[model samples]
Target: MNYNTENLDDKRLVALYKKMLLPRLIEEKMLILLRQGKISKWFSGIGQEAIAVGVTMALNDDEYILPMHRNLGIFTTRNIPLNRLFSQWQGKASGFTKGRDRSFHFGSQEHKIVGMISHLGPQLGVADGIALASKLKHKNQVTAVFTGEGGTSEGDFHEALNVASVWQLPVLFCIENNGYGLSTPTKEQYNCEHLADRAVGYGMEAHIIDGNNIIEVYTKVQELAESIRNNPRPVLIEFKTFRMRGHEESSGTDYVPKALFETWETKDPIANFEQFLLTENILSADNIEEIKIKYTKNINDNLELSFNESKIESSEIKELNDVFNIIENEIITHSSEEKEFRFIDAISEGLKQCMERHDDLIIMGQDIAEYGGVFKITEGFLEQFGKERIRNTPICESAIIEVAMGLSIAGMKSVVEMQFADFISSGFNPVVNLLAKSYYRWGQQADVVIRMPCGGGVGAGPFHSQTNEAWFTKTPGLKVVYPAFPYDAKGLLASAVNDPNPVLFFEHKGLYRSIREDVPTDYYTLPLGKASVLKDGTEITVISYGMGLHWVLETLKQYPEISVDVIDLRTLQPLDTETMFNSVKKTGKAIILQEDSLFGSLSSEISALIMENCFEYLDAPVKRVGSLDTPIPFAKALEDQYLGESRFEAALKSLLAY
Candidate 1:
């Protein structure tokens, strides 16, 4: 169906035409910069301006927008300073991320615009979480998320739509069907007829529209945004358009067919809108030319201003020290009496206390609501905090993690639970790529803790029983915490909740009920990177964490004569080098133990550290002990053999003899 410009009032028609022209001109200028080598890269929204500008203009000023990399028109429509946009492209300190990120990789909290990631699909789930927050607060605001036709095929796209539909969230999923995903056409990308048809499977409202028509995009998006704001439901609108240029400046359009490219050139949204304005007499040709000249001048002036902005100073390039934002000296809670608390209860209590203390704290996991989680770690939380705070999400790990990142960006402290640490592989992309990089790149506080029930020994086998702390330990900008006792579990969890960076809190399932400790009755916090010397010895030093620490302690009972100094590395990322080095320096011998595979494990990292720091002090070569190099066995006998006390006993004897 053709969208008539006559349907819009004169003022609205003029405004839409100008909005379409502004970004087109800016992109044209950016192309010149790209050729001149003034800009590093450019992703143009040349022919698809109407879709981004129309939807952005239709939404309320306070409403949130999650724009993809190509949605440059959103920046113009939202009035993001053109100079700042240019500064980001130029990698100047004046940019939103202080020269840390380029392109649409940086978000503006002041403008209520969340930036996009290259992965593209994860942000859709994050937008769902933002919409969920708005709905819970009764803000009557709608979050509009932009993605391409290719993004619809992603697993996260399916996860986001399913959750939004299940919860009836206030979300506007604006998909720009630009005919191609980078270089592949829609026919080769998906089997579906229209991308909008896939939304029906999720029980979401779906529509298809002529993306070149400004009036159609604006009117339809405006009406749908209003409906979702009032009714709180997700609607998917697919705008059919084409990208006139290649994916980026460096990626040439040699892959495109000549006839197809020529066809889209005539259908340029800006030119089509301009022609409509002139034919309808809503805007005179001279007046439209003046608008074009004005925008051209505006773009050039902003480019000059951005070039003048100061470069990032060397002094400003500080280390990533805020990985764990902890309050050191403050006694959060003081009590003389101690109560015996189980490890699982301590974890639940830490979450409860954090939620009660901070109104912004939220918990999300599968079966966490009425079912209280598969392991009952969140039992009775649904009744206490209500469903709004304790959300039971679908078993989509990527979506769950991405949603948590969104909540964190919105200044909410989120705690996500993985039923088994092994399942973290499903959510690995968002955690390692987005959550770990947020703080270092843009200084955004990823105030989130992913509770991972890890370690083997349970008959659950490989898929469920596994220690994955080593994966995160190797990653920068993330803190890895594993507490062997209930005291550390409760205190460290409280600290993880308060930390401004993302934390992976590993809780060994075997230690959940097998051990108990005298936990402080009142709320308190422990330092994230601090290590506790559980036992002091002069002969040998054994460094371990989680269930591995427990095995070390138990193994020492058989050898009563061995004075082994057992150190629990509560936090793995910032390994307590001082404590471990000092112990090894005193003992002149070291042993590392982990529940992960022996090769390339956390023990390997610790052994390397020992070699580097205490080479001269060591009387013998350091030893490492861990599970066998294979997937956890399903059979009880093989599993025990794979992870048994004999392994630690043998390693300790070898180290002692050496």
Candidate 2:
């Protein structure tokens, strides 16, 4: 095909050739290493180099690009150090993630590279966050996210695209329409004629280009990128490409038809581009040989040098005390003012104070803007903070949660309000896998506080009335806070927002308007992983949090003769073991209580901790008090029986008699 080269200069063409050539050479060496059992696995981008190179070359140095596992050209194009890149592939301690995450499932904040999460769709939302940050910062920088044709079927992809289009975010969704998603053909993937056609439903501009044509990709993408930077709207570009290899080296290409490979082999990006360079007289055939020889040697040398770096010998446990340093800009009002507040009001006051202090802090969720949340937590936030800071998103819990992680990548903080604690299940993957594991896996701090309105009493039933703090408490790298009183709620929330890790802040919906205390109107931070002794006694130590603590205190008032040490575990993740242990040691008897069901509840873990740490001091076997092991019922009568006063009274008698 005769090409248009009036706008493509010679110097730029050679630079593009080198970028594309380097990855080609690197992959060639690495695949050899894979077969030799040197590198454990390889996800080769042998055929799809043009897309990564073209998209990366067009972006500004500071602009972020989230690339998939197959997009090796991106790392090479961005000049990521070959030694470390090789080290990462080899799982060495010197690698980007220091052997914490496997393969290219790692992000490099230094190089403006947000690598793909193994689950392909979530990164699209992350790209939205980076682009939103650019828009908020008024940088006008574009963020380009890459995905295959199969990834387009993911809910996150659709959610992210809708959000980007709705907000007109400067994001370029690059869909490399590779023929198959693993062994499954595109025929089974989507019914659409073209993947780019899906973008029209999202109200975004769509473009289709020949993926094997390097000149077409570079020139066209550069134009679209420049256009988005100027106008600041999303554009999805479908690069019609083919993956020449199987999903990975282990998976053979037997499923692929012979005709497809023959067709794609003729349109090989490197062969065609090299022919174009040769035909244009841009460089001699000797120059092409020299470029390949130079990088091929460089790739071998880097691979050899990287082998000298030791693999991760021993796995290190994540440090719980590695707290995020919150740089306070403005001091809170000095006046000593304490006012009566309900649990809901304290949360509102605390968030308001935090927003006032941190100008860049954003709060995102569904209907959180005009509706002020179902419980009215963010009643006037949209008006006070404006639309940008207080964002109302589509029903995209999975993507929006990672969107907070993306904000953290851009050095911003966010609070994601899950309408109900049960709804958090929708956004659970990013919390457990992506956001929660980020710091441990890659030293990337995702400073996000997820507001969870939890617990049962008002008969909201199985979905809304869940005491699910136990779900996150066991997950490493996440802080869980459940404050019983308004004072603790306000103070703990401030600390949660300021903390450098992801925190699950549980608020009992029953306690929201019912529980009242004198909470300070001024900003204050209650340190997490610290316990407060509400009452000191000698007979027994009862460690509890949230509604369970309230039940303990109330029940204790009725049992006047049975003096007990009442402890409120303000934070669930970093259990204040010191306080709980000392109390149990002093009292010589213990009981762990929680509103969750008995089996696999946080109460059982506390019982284990007491038995392990203070077994000798125990006057009797450590007792656990929890709600009945059954799903929260809808009927008020059944719920009352399930969480009845008799259940706790009986447990107290059994422990006391022992």
lDDT tens per residue, model 1, 352-448: 9888988988899989999998889899999999998999989899988988888886677889999888899999999998898877666676888
Off by over 4 Å in 1: 1-8, 310-317, 322-331
Q: In candidate 2, list every pair of residues with a backbone clash.
A: none
All candidates' TM-scores?
A: 0.96, 0.97
Please estimate how well model 2 matches the true structure, expressed as its whole-model Cα lDDT. Answer: 0.87
Q: Write the per-residue lDDT of candidate 2 for residues 1-658, one digit (tens) a residue.
A: 3456777789998898888999988888888889999889988888899899989998888999999999999988889999999999888877887676777888888888988778888899989888888899989789999999999999889989988898899999999998889888999999999999998899989999998778888889889888888899999999999988889989989999899899899998888888888988988999988887888888878887898876576533333333323234232332478899999999998999889988989999889999998989899998999999999988888878878888889999999999889988888888888787777677788889999999898988899898898889878778899999999999888888888789899999989999999877788888888899999899998888898888888888889998889999999977899999999999998888788888998888888988999988889998887778898998989888787344777788789898
Q: Report the error of model 2 at residue 536, Å.
A: 0.4
Best by TM-score: 2
- Model 2 alpha-carbon miss at residue 305, Å: 1.3
Backbone clashes per model, in order?
Answer: 0, 0
Q: Model 1: clashing residue pairs?
A: none
